[model samples]
Target: SRPPSEEGHSVDELCPNVRIHEGVNVSNIMEVPFVVSIQRRISPNLFAHFCGGALIRPHWVISAKHCFQQQRSIDSYRIVGGTIDSEDTKAESSEIADILYPDEQSGSHDIALLRLKSPLTIAQREDFQQLKLASDVAANKYHSCHCFAAGWGVDSLDSGQPMRYLKRARLSMKFPKKCYEEHLYHTGNFPLYEDPSLYHCFERGEGEDRGVTMEGDSGSPVYCHVTDGTGRVDAVLYGPVSFGYYPEDANGVTIMADKMTYTSNPQIHADWIRKNMKQ
Candidate 1:
């Protein structure tokens, strides 16, 4: 059963036909070498999954700012990488040394960077890869790009439990106008930022094989495949999963609607990210 909503609607009344299932798991760790699991310390010897992030550098990680809003202490968080399975005991782990956020006075961006206590050995590691931020030009062309999002978030809304392994889903970028209009119509409010350019809108690809992010998936990286200078197939970091809007069906069951997932555009904060990563 799903949890009760804030409006005092019982789970049965809110999601009477709720469906639960596991997401499509990544078969190989190398497929998403840049993905990392952000975890919070729950006990002296145990930590629990919290959010998702991407390794942008050997010692730097990019994630959503809201993931740390309730817990600002650096010592309370750590990241695990080099494996797709969240519960892999042999996965590489590191303590978070510090967290950096862009100046709020400039604008509201859901992105943030995490500096690791020590640099992870990315070179010659088959399971580790650092992602590069997408340029403004590339980001502007997302409407025709091939993109996908990967994370260890909950497989379904009703489960409320994070997946034991990473999952990847194909997504199609939505035009800004349609994205904004549909979101406003369903949610009854504008997006977090007034500027549509500050975020990238995506919808799950059609079919039964499609996947969507659920609880605990915030900060997951959305990468778009592109050809680099050398003509080799590569990927660039477009943004991080900021939020999603799930609307109710005729039966009051919450449904993962199209054009719901919103990702914070990294191009808008590329300067801030590069500047902070240097320090």
Candidate 2:
């Protein structure tokens, strides 16, 4: 059994206090070809899901740096893809060869890349593909777009464990300024960082159109569709789920309203990514 959080809830329940409420189960692996389950080897033949990631290349994956907080051997981590079910032992996996981070750390960006020991045959697999990073232009226009995010994150506070199968939610992007303002208004303070440009914020829709990022979702990619002048639609990676604000009431209890989640901007680090991928 997994350990419990300080609040007596399972440790996987609500780290940072967010979740993909009303998210729908992913029916097909092809729908999220770039999604991968980042796992930690708990034993010789057993591995446990630690976080979510996206395949950027056959041999490279992008995930949140915070997921690897405590120092651990690189050999202890691996990436599994081509399946909607995170616990599917039959899904193909690759041992991690190396981990890379940006050279200049601003103490804000929560992104990292993992190189696979061997490149998977992504071209040959119908259910595996690489996700393209959002261009600077597309990244700027993300606030007007509706995006989709998928992960095996826990669904609710009542359910302290992550969903066995993959699930996805359609989310509406919010301006970073608005997100920061709302956070300050409700929580009486700013988030970890005051600079809004360092993060992309999102809010869940109303009624049937609601979902939010939750615990165990760190590093899961959020993608949006961009139509070029030629009328071709492209799904580009915006960022990965990093953190969120949980506003507290007068009594200091968390309130559910305005559950805003944030992701680190990949476009800002694109140059760093390109430079490091070559090495």
Candidate 3:
């Protein structure tokens, strides 16, 4: 049972429910109730929590397809929710029962869905609320708008290690060309960055609040608020965080300070998503 709230909650254009270990933490569990941690159960005593995801339905989740590239099987993965901190093991959890995605055409399609072993009674959980899948209209409406991403990625610009707390970062939709020019690892015409079906959401953190997604953030939801003409803003899921990079400028040198994040276009896969759900 997923209950979606208004587009932009007044307290914040919120991000994945996060708690920052350092700097200003912009997100919390209540703000982003749909966020979840996807983990891999390597053995009886060991586990590797690798990525972030959004709960779209009680039993359905949205995440980056590439997250499963090394996925062994349904039994090897798990989903944890109802908390902002991944280090906390007391959160509600479930085993991933199944996973599905489209064949890749050179990274054009990076979105995937997971089936939880059991339904998440979202209505019963105070800290867990599912996000509504944005319509094509909603997606277009929030274009370049203030969006947020939450996950357990790197803690600092220089750190590659995963943070213990969920982190929220501000971002906006970027055009394909701008994405290529500003966010790619290089200036060359990369097909994935040029693909219209994907959205390049960029975050160059300013001041004390640095907003960026890192290595472990793949499959995290990239979302925003969709305001109806009447000013009612409903939180909508835009896409799943796909990749992040620092692009080069005309000087042929990479800009280490600027971070570019890409998300799979949920609007582009709406039809397939609906059809796949019934199977």
Candidate 4:
């Protein structure tokens, strides 16, 4: 749902939820592949919400487990592949056969695998390519990698409604141990401290011109730099968003999902997808 404002402006026009006007890093946006939009439209009511996701295999989608924890039926969820456009983008939409999540519910190991009824069709664009997944990203190799996250989430934290055009930002990778230290968690199910297994951390420049992750951005992909060999995406899904710190300071910051920490290993989830989607 969009946020309300006293001035009566459309949700996308308000601050924090402001629209991504033309001429804002559109070039880099094309370089990312495997980005997805998670959409759901319940019957009787036509309203919808968009979250980010990534395509691991042609039929398997890696996203946050929490994204579908509330969904009653798989029919309600739709995976939109192949475009970051906010308003009108045609994608290889697929019905979700099943959603796989962890039974223990650890944030650090928070991940979900969506099995599509069918594989996706590739688009011809050179910039659009499949993404890889890394088993381990060494702490020493923190290459200041440039990455991006796209969604219809609010531009700022306070004003709400959804944005019109899909928006993206440049992010730098963070070490898992460093993330643990910065988030202040010393093992054992810390909600505030992201689990290092299923998530990775990234920040904007100086935290001054900080890029934000807000409502509706959940389950979205936080992709690494295009230049990276293998172009492997940081998999794990949604981690700590602005609210994890302070509610009032909306759009305060977000910590991404750690892919290796594993509440449930992605490999197991991948195996489930392969076995289940075929059935």
The digit string of per-residue lDDT tens for model 3 on 7-115 reads: 5433223322222234536356776778888888768845666899988777888998888887476777888876777767677788888888865564578888888
Off by over 4 Å in 2: 1-23, 105-107, 123-129, 136-144, 183-190, 206-209, 229-231, 248-257
The per-model lDDT (C-alpha) reads 0.75, 0.75, 0.70, 0.52
Please give the ranking of all candidate structures by TM-score, highest first, separated by commas.
Answer: 1, 2, 3, 4
lDDT, candidate 2, 1-279, per-residue tens? 444434455422322222324547788777778888998889998988879998887888889989988798988888998889888978889999888877545657788888898875652575454566766445432222337778998888668777889988777787778877876775668466667777888877444545777888889998765543233445678788898766677898876545677888888888888777798
Model 2 score (lDDT): 0.75
Best by TM-score: 1
Q: How close is candidate 3 to the true structure, as a TM-score?
A: 0.78
Q: TM-score of predicted model 2?
A: 0.81
Candidate 1 structure, TM-score to reference = 0.82
- Per-residue alpha-carbon lDDT of candidate 1 for residues 1-279, written as tens digits (9 for 90 to 100): 334435454433533232212345688777778888999988888888879998878788899999999965688788998788888887888999888888777567998889999766652376454576666335332222346789988866678899888888877677777767766776568546766777887888543446667778899998766442222344678788998877678997777754378888888788988888877
RMSD of 3: 6.4
Candidate 3: list runs displaced more than 4 Å: 1-27, 103-107, 123-129, 136-145, 180-187, 205-210, 229-231, 248-254
Question: Candidate 4 — which residues are off by over 4 angstroms?
Answer: 1-30, 44-47, 86-90, 102-108, 123-127, 136-144, 185-198, 206-210, 226-279
- Candidate 3 residue 235 Cα shift, in angstroms, is 1.5
